[model samples]
Target chain A: MPDLAASSKRPPPWALRILVLTYLTIFLFAPLLALGVESFREGALSLWQGITEPESLLALRNSFLLAAIAVVLNVLFGIAAGLVIARQRFWGRALLDGLIEVPLALSPVMVGLAFILIFGRTGWLGPWLSQFGVRVIFSFPGLIIATLFVTVPFTAREVIHVLSEIGEEEEMAATTLGASRWQTFWHVTLPNMRGALSCGISLTAARALGEFGAVLIMGGAITGSTHTATTWIFTAVDERNNGAALGLSLVLGLCSVALLLLVEKLRARAHERR
Target chain B: MRPALTPTSRWSLLLRGAVIAWMLLLVVLPLVALAIHGLRSGVPFFWAAITEPQAKDAVALTLWTALLISLINAVLGTATAWLITRYRFRGRRLLATLIDLPLAIPTLVTGIMLVVLFGPMSPLGAWFEGHGIYVAFHSPIIVLALGFVTLPFSVRMVQPVLADMDRAEEEAAASLGASRLVTFLRIIWPSIGPAVLGGALQTFARAMAEFGSIVVVSGNVPHETLTAPVYIYGQVESGDSHGAAAVALALVTLSLLVTLFSKLMVRWGVRRHA
Candidate 1:
């Protein structure tokens, strides 16, 4: 790739480069810089104090808890679904693949609404679930489900891409040598796609942590109990508490930057291995 | 292709069944619930719900803004992709990394970032407001937030295609006395066109559904800056489940159509390359 660039006789037009850079500066970098500047505008001590308030702390904790649970569930489901789609041919396989991507395209608001239609007081499952004394909406379970819906495609999509590229020859060989299906999966397939899985996991974690719209609708963003970091930021902004909003935004922004860096490193390593 | 590697065994059957059941519960059930709930009051009520003045305005605003954002992204994203793939320069890696930042960042933070930069309270925002130009809490902020959140789509989509392109044809055209512009239009655009279009459609679908960032950035004035997702959120909050579901179902249907077309474009691109 480097050689190809070097071999080219002409450098790209400078105007195009400047245009792109200017766009990035105004649209992306400037806003990010503003976030950092404003977060500490009140000084570091105040920023720290704002983020450490009981509500903020609980919101952050809830975000982490939801993200953790979403990651585990999505990873397990992603692996199983990815394996099925890649390793077997069956009726509705293509349909299933397309369906998996539905969450990505659907509005998060719609996702919340859909669940409410199923679990809200007047919903189809409401009466049956009430008989069991179970509440789903406006609760932790609803928040986790909404996160899961949004993050569902990441791991499975990554796993499918890797599996398709690596092929089934290794698994076939293992099976031919008398390895059980589980053994072959554990020893062969899992080892080969570790990088892709991690990439997917990081993506899921980032998305789950950052989820807001669906969680807000589903969990009701009740101040202390239901507010994730994002909903907390929204409420903070609504209450004209710019200090807390900016402070928490800065923290989430930094976490996402770290996650983005991790994804890039993983992608680079995966490319090198290929 | 090769004789089935592992014949369907009882364990394999169980795995497939379990995966399918999980998908049904997680993915299909909610969609069905939503559809049923949306239509429960009959088509007239559903129609009236979505056609209400505020709902109509919200959907229109979302569509137009998303369209504008996608068009801008198409040009800028392709330019960025081309620069990164064809040029050797300092900070190129950093630029590439920054392109993906929007995806990794909590979108609510993205809104806060913009608000800090241009909200009415900030100096820049106050300056704009003094001139009667609203950046945050208006239609423009919707564009910025959507643009920020959807920035990476086209660039990421086009980058790989550009990198993997066989430069032989381009070089041949260059050596034959074709100007760079002529060569690009004749040789390069044909291959990347489908990818760019696919990416743009995906961006449009994504932008239409964006909620977290826009809700924070746009003040959500009904019949003014309110977007479809935010409007839906409002309905949900007000206990108007039927209205929310009807409008949500409309948004989902449109997004699904756009997504299906995007997939077709991608498949067409792959076939062309093959």
Candidate 2:
């Protein structure tokens, strides 16, 4: 009411507000509301028990391990690519930058299939590696490989964009001022990259937790072994065990929301800095 | 006095090289293997693999479903971004987050959410079934699942551009006797086209790649429903890696084409803006 007169200059029609509210309620809120309501319908304690159940725990454990491995791999990639694209004058830097986004635009199942076609027992590498008795598809190695494939660019993309904007003048100046390149990087570049690195890691971690298609296809969804939280949730829902599935989903949902918030904050700050 | 370049500089240079190597190892190599596998299997075999009456049907279904999702999301996403940016309303942040929630939620959970919202027992599900508009576990229903996850791309891509738009131009157009619709067409639209188109491509790519959610909802019938990704998975599981590679190659080619298309759109937008 206080700003009503101020809004006299540009008040969107009330109809617009009403329409937007109604649209979201139907398209976005309604279904998720169903999941949330049905899950807690039996009270939180039972849901908590479902979350702690051995099968649920095993799924959580497997997903966590898989996500951790994937994130570690991607972070190393992110730091490396971020460094090169930020500082190097390479012949193919532009092409490499373009290449980083290929995964984001590809289908997850296609990604899964790509992994299987390359690492499955009869795949090009699969047979050669099989000679060494290394199994990829339907194993932890497959899960990590697939997850890494999807996750590689998230951090690098984030870090590169950040690093690109932060010019090399500072690093070069520091290096010329007697600091070793390593020291200059650690003290200058690393500190500036802290926010991007954090954001990138969070994204990788969040996606790792939620990965399903690749893990399901390559990892085989064996109980207590290869089943990720997403796969476990899928199985539970399919088996008509809504209670346990919702409980498991809630856990992963919370992690995703948290990581996304961090990403949003970092990206917003970056945008504002511009 | 110039600070002496130390071993640190060389080491960091090597690190950058390693990063480039890593990108090749992680991204390029797997794809190369897939491509080589496709080649080894020969075009005759791939033609056989894909044209295996049912297999051809699967690829067609996947493309059409993805295309449908992209078309629907393009309209809805534009409407959403228009509302979110052009108006300041209650629950706007919640609306924004809800749209993007698909990006963060595990796709399998997305499937479960759809099932609960429209499965046999739910009120809407019952109504839809009663009206002979069964949405659960159906072909058209797959578009809905694809659209659910791809919805975020359009809005995110558009909102930032809209927020950055010059409203004075719109006002000037209106004062010059252009109706709101005409003003939007002449002024705002030219600016947002590339973004909307790029978003559409991303959605199409995502929809085609859909696995976790679609698999859950589609019931994965052979030619009637199985997507190319799922079809590839089936081949690999059946110990036919060569057949899988053939299909995987087709999927990868589609991805490359779509990505090039998106790049073209974004580049055109940049040039237009310039």
Best by lDDT: 1
lDDT of 1 by residue, A34-118 (tens): 8878766778887787799899999999999988998898888888876888877789888888878889998888999899889
lDDT of 1 by residue, B1-274 (tens): 2223343666666767877887788889999987887888999999999899999999999999999999998999899888888877777778888989999999889888888889887899999999989788889889989888999999988887888788999989999999999999999999999999999999999999999889888988999999999999999889998888888888888999999999899899989987
- Distance from true position, residue A112, model 2, in Å? 3.0
How close to the true structure is residue A226 of candidate 1, measured as C-alpha lDDT? Answer: 92
The C-alpha local distance difference test score for the whole of candidate 2 amounts to 0.77
Residue B267, candidate 1: alpha-carbon lDDT: 90
Q: Write the per-residue lDDT of candidate 2 for residues A11-113, one digit (tens) a residue.
A: 5677665665565555567767877876767479877887888988888888888788877777778877887777676678798888888777666666776
> Each prediction's DockQ?
0.59, 0.43
* Model 2 steric clash total: 1
The residue-level lDDT of candidate 1 at A221 comes to: 91
Tell me the TM-score of model 1.
0.96
Runs with alpha carbons beyond 4 Å of true place in candidate 1? A1-11, B1-7
